[model samples]
Each structure stands twice: as C-alpha cells, then as structure tokens.
Target chain A: MDKSTKCALCPQKAVVHLKYFNRKLCKQHFSELTQDRIRKNISKNELVDKNNRVAVAVSGGKDSTTLLYSLANFAEKFPIELVGITIDEGIEGYRSESLKVVEKNYKKLGIEYKILRYENEVGKPMDEIVKKDQRLPCSYCGVFRRDLLNKAALEVDADKIATGHNLDDEVQSILMNYIRGDFSRLARTGTKTAADTGFVQRIKPLSVVPEKEIALYAMLNNFEVYWGECPYSHEAFRSEIRDTLNRWEERSPGTKYQIYNGAENLKELLKGAIGGAILFECEICGTPSPSVICKSCEMKKEVR
Target chain B: MDKSTKCALCPQKAVVHLKYFNRKLCKQHFSELTQDRIRKNISKNELVDKNNRVAVAVSGGKDSTTLLYSLANFAEKFPIELVGITIDEGIEGYRSESLKVVEKNYKKLGIEYKILRYENEVGKPMDEIVKKDQRLPCSYCGVFRRDLLNKAALEVDADKIATGHNLDDEVQSILMNYIRGDFSRLARTGTKTAADTGFVQRIKPLSVVPEKEIALYAMLNNFEVYWGECPYSHEAFRSEIRDTLNRWEERSPGTKYQIYNGAENLKELLKGAIGGAILFECEICGTPSPSVICKSCEMKKEVR
Candidate 1:
C-alpha cells in the first residue's frame, strides 16, 4: 500500500494526515470527521458535559462500534469518562454477533462492559414475548430496548448514555414522523434527550454521519459487524423511510446532506416546538417522562 | 333478483329495498344503514347545518361520487344546497373517465357543477409541469386540486367544501403525517373543523365510511365512477403508507378505523404542537390557509 495514495478509508486527502494504530488515514479521517463533528455539535448544542459519566449503548453494530471507537479516541483528548452498556434482546442468531463485537471491542479498547440480558431484566426474551403477544414486533422491541438501555444506564450509575444513531436514520425518522403526523415522537426526537432524566441522557455522536460514510469507515477499519438483519424486523418501518430518503438523495445528490443541515437549522425550532421541559418521572420505574408513566413502563405493564 | 334474500346492491333489508336504478340495490330507502350512519354521524357531530351552502368536491372517483350522491340525497330531505366542484389537473389518459362520470352524475341529479381547468386557472397541466419542474406530479396535483377546490368553492359562494375522504384515506394520511412528524397537518385533519375564523371549513361526510363501503354504495347505486387511478400516483409516498396500513388492517380488522379514531384523539394534542391552525387566505389567491400562501399558490409558483 503506497502511503502517497489516498487513504483507503476516506477519499479526501488532507495535508496534516495522522497515523493512528498503523492505519494510514488523513487528518480528515472519516471516523474522526464524523466523531469530531458529532462531539462538537453536541457540545456546541449544549448536549454533553464534563460532569457526565456517559454510558456507551453498544449494540456491536458498525455504527455503535464506530461510536465506541471514536468516544475512546475522544476520551484520550477530553476528560470524558466512558463505560460500555450492551442490552442483549435474546433474538436467535442476531444478538450473538452484536454481543461478540461489543465484548471484543470493549476488551480491545479496555472499557468496562456491562451486559444486561433481556430475559433476566425484562423476565422474557423479546422473541418469546413478541411471539406470544399480539402487538407488532417493533412495538415490543422498541419498548423493551428503551426500557433495558435506560435501566442499564441507571444501574451502572451513568449520567448520560451515548448511542450511534446516524443521519440517514434520523432523517428517515423525521420523515416518518412527519408522514404519520406523530408529533409527540417528533417533538421528543433530538440528538440528545433528557426525557429519561432519572435513567440516562441519550446522545448520538454519529447523528451527522451518512450511512455510506459509516459503512465505508467500518469497512476500512475492518470492524466486526453483524451483517444479517434482525429476524423480527418485520416491524421496521424505517426501511420504507430509508428507501424514500435514498430516492430523494439519488435524484438530488446532496439532498441527504442538506437534510442534516436542515436538522441543525431547525434545532431551535424543534426544541421550541418539541419543548424539552416536558420531562417527568415514570411512576412505575421512576424513569423520566412527559407523562405520569413513561411509554416503556406503560408498554411493559400492558404486556404483562 | 331475490326480494326476500339480501339485496346485492343495498346489502340491507329495508321496506324500500329494491334493485332501483338497475344496480340491484336492496331498496331506494331514504337512509341505507351506512349512509344513514354517516349522515347521522355528520348530524350528531354537527358537521353541517341548514345555514350552510356546501360545495361537494368531486373527482369522478367512487369515493367522491358516492359522497356527492349521498350529499344530493341529503339535500333532498334536509334544507341544504349542494354544488359540485371539479378541478381538472390535465393528466393524459386519465380524468376523462372521472370527468365523464362527474358530468353524467351532475346532469342526472340536476346538481350545479363547476369545472376548474388547470391549464386556464393554474396555467399548466400536472404532467407537463412535473416534466419541466422535476417535482412529483401528485405533489403539484394535490396542491392544484386543493387550490382549485377552494377557488371554486369561493367562486360558488359556498360556506363549506365537502370532500369524499373516507376512513382508509384518513388513516393513511394520519399514519403518513405521524411517520413524517408533521403535526400541523394532523392537527387540522378530521371529518369536520370549526369555521376557524380565517378559513372556509372542509367536511368529509364519508368520514366514517370505509373505502370499500363507498365503492359498494357507488356500484349499487349505479353512480358513475372513474375506476382508473391517477397516472402520477405511483410516485406518491402515501401509497407506501396505504400498503402498510392495508397490511395492518388485514392483520386486524377495523385496525385502520381505530387508527383514524386515535388520530382524532390526538387532534387537540397536534394543534398545540406545530402545524396548528386552520386555513387562512392565500395572500396571492385570497384562499384559506394556515401558511402565508395557500398550498396551491405555492405549487403554482414552484411549477411556473
């Protein structure tokens, strides 16, 4: 591999390139560019703080791996204390890959990893619950995932939890919410949320990164990923949103980028409209919410 | 054919049950259960009053035709005036059938009918404009249709513009709006609205009626209807919503109806969020809108 050639990771070649862990990447490293932008965005937007002991919501997916990797990189420079939190939903053939990648990355990066099992915590595997329940799979998974992530973050004594939600996902969600007119979800959605205040503040560092860039960065770094989709993803409405956004992106190449910028521009409008102060604690779990009981607690109680 | 048996047309056993008008309708009863239920819903909900002069927006489709037919029927019994308004979007190989149906229905029913040709009023047909502007045809068509409807409504001096939107359409739109997080649209959505100070209120008398019910009513009554779909509708994002909702509905009967009801429940919540307010006049067209310019004026500008 000729060093003079463009970095295999990112096509962009900047002059002040840095060699980290034998990877020849430009100063504008794909991961770094993404991570730095997200970090600065969150900080600038007043999302994260020095007092926060953040929980890394690791799923062992490429996005989560990149998040963990970048947070570790950021920690070397910043005084941020980070710990890994993984929730195993106990889906057959799915959780294993994510678990392996998450555990391996935590070990490799020397971060404390806490595995919260769904069956142990929620009293049943998501698959079993979904199979028996008449509710949509996504309805179950979303409620369970949120419940577990928040609970794990709280149990581990972390003030903030970081997840790897990307631009494509965010925009799709924005579009989906707009289409369905789901104002509550839209109002609640942001790069960071204090909704689960008693549990953990959730932040997305990769919120600005596009799907292509994340995939490229993951590939270049040879990050172990769970390539197959969740078997119970029949309820994933996001795929429709992804395709819709992708169509627009393809027709107008920079549309997705513009959407990210739009999100940034609309941040204040969204905050004002969505209102951050709507937070209250769930009566059942004492989790943060806009209502007396959080959605997850409501769902869990209903399911039971 | 079988008088004692259920009438294929009416699907109801009433004294007025007969295959009147050659459609094999069970009877020429003043109130078919669904139509009566719909009218009673409109009446009980106080959707319309004797003081109102309503413009029935017709597209020559089954739903709209059924709406107009029922509205005409209502006019006969109740002290109400009815006018039909059609906006011609100028799509090739389409609209002709619907236009014919509209004309035939109006002529037979002796109802006043007005046609707003897009070429004359909006200065361009949808297909031609879409080709030049690279915008989705339905996006442009929807705006034009709405603008024209309001324009024609105002032209006819009608208090309320009645649309043929049914349960499925409402559910799909609610879902789409929720998915897109557009609370504004969801806020103003329903069978009826207050004559919210600055705008002409729109009403959907067929609000409780399902699409199939409308189609059956149209077929049984021999109400002429355009069976073909809009040429540009394939590009619509709502189709995906429709598909998703359709599958959900099939999985659970009356699920779509419940979703519509859920949307109704959220109407107040949506209004308090963004996209609140009813139609205000378009500064350009002097038509009703919550936005500065009406959607039609916006689309016309976009195409021009």
Candidate 2:
C-alpha cells in the first residue's frame, strides 16, 4: 500500500514490492534480484553448459521479452550463445505488432533471429484454420507452435530451446494437466528441460519468476515489450484455472510458488512411477511423438 | 431444464436430471443407478469381502446416512456384517441432532452402533481445542476423527472402516494436497483402502457419487438424516477450492468426476513410484506412523 517505501537492501526509493516474498526493492536492486534469481534457477537446474547454443522462443510478450533480456544479461557471465525464434501464428493484428517488438529487442541486443510462420509450415494460417473448424484453437495452436519451435531449433543447430514460461504459466499448466487428468503432461510439468529424439532439450529460465514480476522488470528495465492478448487466446478452461490460482494467490501470498515448488517435489517422488515421455517417430512427419503420427501432422491432415 | 422428461432407460416420468451425463431418470431408475454404481465401485475396488465385518463412520450427515442405508441394502446380497461408528466432537446443537439420526438409522436397520467422544479419548472437546489454539480447526478435527475411527474399528473387530467421502470431498482433497505441495499426502489419496499395522483398512463406498446425488438419494430413501453442518466447519481454504470446483462443474459438467477418476488412473500408473504409506509403531501410542510418533498423538500432546 505504501508506494514510497525504501528498498530492503539499499537506501534508494523502492520501485517494486513483491508480496510473495514480502520485500520492496529499488529499481537497480529489483533488476539485479530478477537476474540473480534466473541465474540461480539456471545453475540449480543445470539448464546450460559451457559453449551451449540456446534458442529462445520470443513472442514479444512480457514473459518472453523479459526472458530474452535476462538470459542475454546472463550470457555476459556464462559462456552461452543466444538466438531468438518467433512463431507467427498468423493472427492478423496481433502477430505483426508483437513481431516488431521482438525484432527491436533482438536487433538492439545483436542476437541472431529467425521467424517461422504457420502458413509456411502447416499450409494454413491460424485465422484460416479456425474458420474451418473452431472447436479448440488452443489445441491446434499448441501442437503447431510446438512442432515448429522444435523444428526451428533443430534447424538452427541449437542444443536447447528456451521458452519464456514464467511461474504463473508453469503453475497454470500444472493445474490444467491435473484437472484434465493428463498424467504424462503432469509428470513432465516440473522439469526444467525435456529431451526427445530430433527434439532439442527445452529450458525455461524464467519458470520461477512470477508474471507480474516479469512485467514489472520489463517496465523498470525499459525493455520494448508488447502487452497484448492474442486474438486466438480463448482458452476458457485455462482462464478458469488462472482465475482460481490468482484468487488463491491473493488470499494466500506465494500460492503460485507453492504450487510450482510442490509439483517439482512430487515429480521427484513419482519419477519412477511416471517415466519419461515415450519417443516414437511420427509416421507422417517423422517428428517425435508418442503415437504413430504426431499431433501436428494429425491436425494438419484434418485441417486440410 | 425439462423437468417432465421421460427416463432414458424407461418410460416413467423423470424425477431427476443428471447434467453431467445429460440424462433424465425416473425415481426408481435413479435410485437403481445410484445403488448400482456404488455396488460396482465396491466390487471393482474390492472394498468389501465376504464375511468381513465393516465399521461405517457415521456423522449423522446426509452423506453418512445415505452411506449406511446403501451399505445396508448392499449387505442383503453380500455376506458381510455392518456396524455404525460415530465420533461426537462435542459441538453443541450439531452433534446431538446428528447422533439421533445415526441412532434412528442404526435402530431401523438393526445394525450395531458405537459412539466415541473427544472428551473420552482426548480429554477435551473440539470447542475447547479451538478455544485454546484458535487456528486450523479442521486440522485438529481431522487428526482426532481419523485416530478415533481407526481405534473404534479395531475395537469392534471390524476388518474395514468405511467413511462417507463423496466425489467432491475426494477431488477437493487431491487438489488441496497438490496446492499445499504435500507429495506424501497426494500419493496416498487414491487408495480405496489404506492398510497399516494395527489399523483397520478404510473404505469409501460413496467416493464416486457426487454430494448432490447423495443428498437426493437420502431424501428419496426417506432416511431421517440431519443436514446441519458442523459448528467448526470453517475451512476457508477448502471452501475456496470447493467453490472453484463447483463453478467449473457448473460450466463444464463432469469436472469433479474427471479429477477423481484421473487421480485414480494416475495413482495406478504411479503406484511403483509412490509406494504404500510407511508403517512404524508410534513412540507415544504404538499406532502405525511414518515418523517416531503418529500425527494424532502429536496433535493430542499439543492440544493437552
């Protein structure tokens, strides 16, 4: 409630107050703390090794943009090469604006970038795909985006692909899998990186950071970021879960952290029970999939 | 929405419409369906065995009353014996009325009944327990009730102890344990019956049935059930989860069942990963416990 409180670590005026940890910080200290937390997460999870080429999936949103900036900052200390990859889902007004923001950040940072389009890969843009059969846009978008990310990462010869999945996104995903009774997805929710044949290991450096904190970090650091909802983001069930978690976090501070941390612990205990995802080649596309054909190829065929 | 629709299985006018399954059923068919579901659950899970004496934990609430009546009907076919066990937490205006209902049902069914009081076992009532500590009444109540139930069942020489936990309660518990980051509790949630040294195996016949259906079944069966809530039923967090699940169920029917069924499936898949509850004699009471002393004994010592 007090906007002009002093920073906990220094004498400078506080710029951000974290309710979960019950701390207020000045601009300089807040940025440092944000980077430090991501650094610790990377080291704790062994997310990167010496001379590792990392591909970051940037969507121009606060989470991805913050992740890219933080990881680039982290690169100054660690021996890692960073590359930016963006998927244009072909949502008219949304994708174009976000792409501009992504391009600005990558250009300013002097990082190499690649843009993948849904139309090029799947033969249909999301806008057209939804027009044909609009039952679950997320399902189609998720499968396609994931397939393209992996493909682009492999093409770029990257060892690991990084995503801007923050604590809120991670917890929402964990709760969603639990609610949907999808055990395989639930089991893999806690891992920092996942590996399969022909699929680069995926890393989430910002998985521990809260979304609000990421947005605040972007604002404090003056990162060019676009904070717009995707036009095709109509996940009603996910929205319900997000609202439930937000309410819980409001009532009990650090609930999001607890859910994420608890999931990690459970995953460890159940590791033997929930083995790693089974890898098989998709008959149609030769992509890594549990079944004969990957989800993307199946959807692509259906959409066509 | 149509109140006068005919039963899906029969030509009789519908008495209840199940939104989840999207079917209307006559009173006779609804009752049959309810009982048949429980019967199949018991058989599928092997909740009861022939010639086994089972102790039903009755709190005089609709769930317990309905459970007792249903189990009584079930016993007519199976060769198992039934007895009722009630714990009087000493909540004034609440326990007394519920005890009358328990007594009435036990008398009508000719089932043996036993009453255990907190004052007798723990040397104080729930009211006094809360008056002293005044935090987490549910925690204290749960520990005390579970301990008393196990002790009473053992004393009555019953092989299994049955509780009135419905679908809502089961799913709430699964989600709550998950949110709390309690992996140990989450691992033990889906077992139909938990076995421990000197502890009776516990069974939940109504675990698959929803709360609303349980209430309706009690009404149709004309069981003089007490619908009063416990005076100490102020679980704020649980209430939040209940409301969240209720809203989701309203928006998408079968959400509760999906959570429960999914948990069961996951538990089966993770059985090897999550082994049975660790068993050891409690240092204070010689009861089965994973630690030096059991949770109930630990709480009793603190309460005293």
Best by lDDT: 2
| Candidate 2 lDDT by residue in tens digits, A1-304 | 6555999999999988889888899999998888989999999999999999999999999889988988898999989999999999989999988999999999999999899999899998989999999568888999899999988898888998999998998999999888888867766655465554447888899998888888899998888999888887788877888898999999999999999988787677666666676778899889878899888999999887
lDDT of 2 by residue, B94-121 (tens): 8877888789889999999889999989
The docking category that best describes candidate 2 is medium
For each candidate, the DockQ is 0.07, 0.70
Global lDDT of model 2: 0.87
The model with the greatest DockQ is 2
lDDT of each: 0.73, 0.87
Report lDDT (Cα) of residue B248, candidate 1.
51
Off by over 4 Å in 1: A1-33, A87-103, A115-152, A165-190, A195-197, A208-213, A224-304, B1-33, B86-104, B112-148, B168-190, B197-199, B226-255, B272-304
lDDT of 1 by residue, A1-304 (tens): 3566566576767433323223456545655665667678667766667766889998888788888887888787777888999999888788876788788889998999788887887777777788778877787777778888878887789878899898888887765554454645655666876544455678888887777777777777787766667787874466655775676566445656665554444344445445445668778877767799888777766665
Error of 1 at B67 (Å): 1.2
Error in Å for residue B288 of model 1 = 6.2
